[model samples]
Target: MSIAIDFNHVVKKYGDQAVIPGLSIKVKEGEFFTLLGPSGCGKTTLLRMVAGFNSIEGGEIKFDEKVMNDVKPSKRNIGMVFQNYAIFPHLSVKKNIAFGLENRKTPKAEIERRVDEILRIVQIEKFKDRLPENLSGGQQQRVALARAIVINPDVLLMDEPLSNLDAKLRIELRNAIRKIQKEVGITTVYVTHDQEEAMAVSDRIAVMKDGYIQHAGTPQNIYHRPANLFVSSFIGRSNILNATLFATNDKTEIVIHDKHRVVLTNIRQELIKSTKTNVQVCVRPEEFLFTSDTNGLKGKVQRSSFLGLNTNYFIELESGETVEVIQESDIDTLIPEGSVVYLKLNQAKVNVFNEDGSVNLTEGVKNDAAGEVQSEVNNVAI
Candidate 1:
């Protein structure tokens, strides 16, 4: 059965260093929540705290209203899938999957029933008799998954389970994991350093930094409407251009290097003052469109490469800022390197950040009769 998990003002420390410093988060029942960050960013440490492998120094960690600060790991009744695919080489896939159930002192007939059901759920029934050494990496990982789920734990914790697999296997197994997770309806807390893995498999993701959550939202929100500069630059390939907001009589214009400017009709009211504070515009590489009109920003292609589905171009703007653009490969011809080009932003997906690294309150707004509100807002619930 699935259960909710909550972390309230949790704190963890290593000697004098604070690893996780007063972080509060909530994982709803049956939600596939992922903790994502670079190494040393405390994603793993947070997962370990949930699994009871690491203790919280300051606050409470509860599983469905049960205060588990003093609870032991074994009594947590949580199933964990590690990155190393900790299956016993001496045991067959079926036996490996049955280990958890056996340790729980479940009856023989019921263990068999659960092992068979879990193997089929992970699509590893064909390899049930094969040993871990006899199976491929993906197959071995499936066996490990079957083992974890066979016991029907209230929550499933995965710590970079797909990091050891190759690219092709990683994609295939992540898809399978997402499908199985939905079918099992287990409240899951997963940890990974991979952006694609986290974004592709998670129902919601908490992007972490310095043991604190930088942003928590759906993958689309984290990508399109990043809460701050670090999130915008980390979640995806973003070209952050320095721009200054100039207040005019009727509207605002974001001036770039004094020569190029985009009309900033939808901007936060506080920025409308005549004082010049630092501001930046975050645009994804795929959000730029090639245009022939000189009315847009002028740039020169520094380098160009044709990938399978898209051609990437590195363009140096007249302001000496480099912006990367990803164009579709179906174009009739490729723009040669050093070719002078004009580029314009789609604007709808653009995000603005203030000097203090907070998102501009009016970022991506669609102004009309209503006050400034984020455009393309979809399922903002974290």
Candidate 2:
């Protein structure tokens, strides 16, 4: 019984400071939505409002068309999994999971059935009698998940549940969480500052900054077609280039700092408009094609590191700006620190920004570059 969650012009304030100002977004029923941003950016505050831990100063917070601003957290039937595994150290796994059901005065036999079902769902049935102290971090997390979900909550809220685990375990547990979430079909709202984690798990992500949602879309849309300079720089490693854009004979041409020229012929006709200032271009580390011959921008490799699957090269462009290039290492070769090389920008996929850190939708408007990565991943055949 998942319900859609909506924030209608929501605002949160502390005395004189506004934390979340005029924010409006919706999470579909049974959708895995994420609030992704850096620290002190009010993502957690917004999540708290949904969980009934904080008071909404203005506007409405709705669950399935019902206003929930004054609803008690306990009455909301929402389950929250906190950052720390928050399980009872003295209680066994079975007792901890059954605690919630017991509070509701559920029938003894029904409690056993539900508890047993959740344990198996979380794959922790074998450790039913084990205490939280006796279990591994991953296992304790599983117990925490089991406890939160055993009551059949309608909306599942997880706040940085995997932040304390090691990198290897983080990946493993995140995948497990996604799988388990899908199995339950609970409306989920996950919060994390980790960009890769958000992209990996979210069906859609909202990039927040300074109490404002800068961009909101699918993971592919946020990464490949960022709405502004902050999003481009924050979501991933992007080479931001200052360029001038002008049109001649209905042809859009962007000159990099008015030096290197690249013709953009694929910009959407409706998005093209007149601009008054220089444009900022965003290109990912993997978007640059490297070659020995000077086919595009010529630069010298300032440093290179072999990352097993991909080789990371820090190249200093002739324009005196440093750009990072990530190339897949199919070949067993290396480019020394001071080698000269040529790199070409995949312009069709490039994102252009206005002077005010907003995207220059007037150029390269759609998410075409996202398709390029799909082919790259498909080539791996796994």
Candidate 3:
């Protein structure tokens, strides 16, 4: 059966160092949730807390509806797949998979049936008699997974299970793991520092930084509507520019680098009302288009390189700041290095932020009328 996992105000400190501070999150029953962050950002620590391997300094962890603060690791009924694969070298695949069931003293016949069923599910039935040293890395990982799931634990925790495999094998095994998780309908919490892997497999992701959650949302939401400057820069590539806000009776205009001006039509009126007139603007690398017209900001192409699907250019603006732009590789007119070109930003693709780096603009709006309409809707809803 699936179970919900909850971390309520969890804090873990090692001696004088605090690894996780007041972390709180919920993983729904049968959901695939990931904790994504850089090394030492407490993602693994948080996963260990849920696995009952690490003790919390404060707050509570609950499985289903029961508080698990004092629950033994064995009694927590959770399966964990580690990065090292942890398969016993001396035991055959069949024995490794049935080890958990045997520890619970299941009948010999029942353990045999369950082991066979899991081996087939993981498509490793042909290797049932083989030892760990005889199988490939991917195959051994599958064996580890099969062993973890044979007991049918309420929750499954994986800590960078694909980090050891080659790139191609990593992709293959990642898809296989996601497929198995969906088929079994087990609540899962995966920890990884690879943003691409987290985005590809997680139902929802919590991006952590400095031992705290920076943002939490679906992959699409986190990528397109990041909550802060750190999230915008971390999840993907974005060009952040300093700007000054100039608000009129209806619209908010941002002056970039003292020369270029952009009208921000998506900012909330309440947020703009509190603005101190200076802000920052974030633009994704693909949002700018190169043109020959004299209307936009002029920049010299510092370097341009073809990278498979797209061409990447490092452009130096008139103010000496460098910005990156991505365009289709097959474009007829290429901006050569040292050539001056006009860079036009699509107003629809810009994100505005306050001085403190919080997102100030709602994602989409083309004009003041749309902003007013959204404001009215928000007011009515509230």
Question: How accurate locally, in lDDT, is each candidate?
Answer: 0.83, 0.83, 0.83
What CA RMSD would candidate 1 show?
A: 5.1
Runs with alpha carbons beyond 4 Å of true place in candidate 2: 268-276, 292-295, 362-382
lDDT of 2 by residue, 1-382 (tens): 9999988878899998999877887889999999999999899999999999999999899999899999999999988899998999899999999999999999999999999999999999999998888899999999999899989998999999999999999999999999999999999999999999999999888888887777777888788777667878889889888888775565777788456677777544454446434677788999988866554788899998898999999999998999999988767688889988888778778876665555545342232222222233223210
Q: For each candidate, what TM-score against the reference?
A: 0.92, 0.92, 0.90
Candidate 3: misplaced stretches above 4 Å?
274-276, 331-333, 358-360, 363-382
Model 2 lDDT vs. the true structure? 0.83
Tens-digit lDDT track of model 3 for 1-382: 9989877778899998888767777788999998888898999988988888898899889887899988889998889999999999999999999999999999999998989988888889999999999999999999999999999999999999999999999999998898889988999999998888988898988888877777777888778777667778888899988888887886777787776777767676665564347777888999888877776878899999888789999999988889999998885766679998888787776777777674445543221111222243334210
Count of backbone clashes, every candidate in sequence: 0, 0, 0
Please give the lDDT score at residue 336 for candidate 3. Answer: 72
lDDT of 2 at 352: 67
Clashing pairs in 1: none
How good is model 1 by TM-score?
0.92
Candidate 1 regions exceeding 4 Å error are 270-275, 364-382
* TM-score result, candidate 2: 0.92
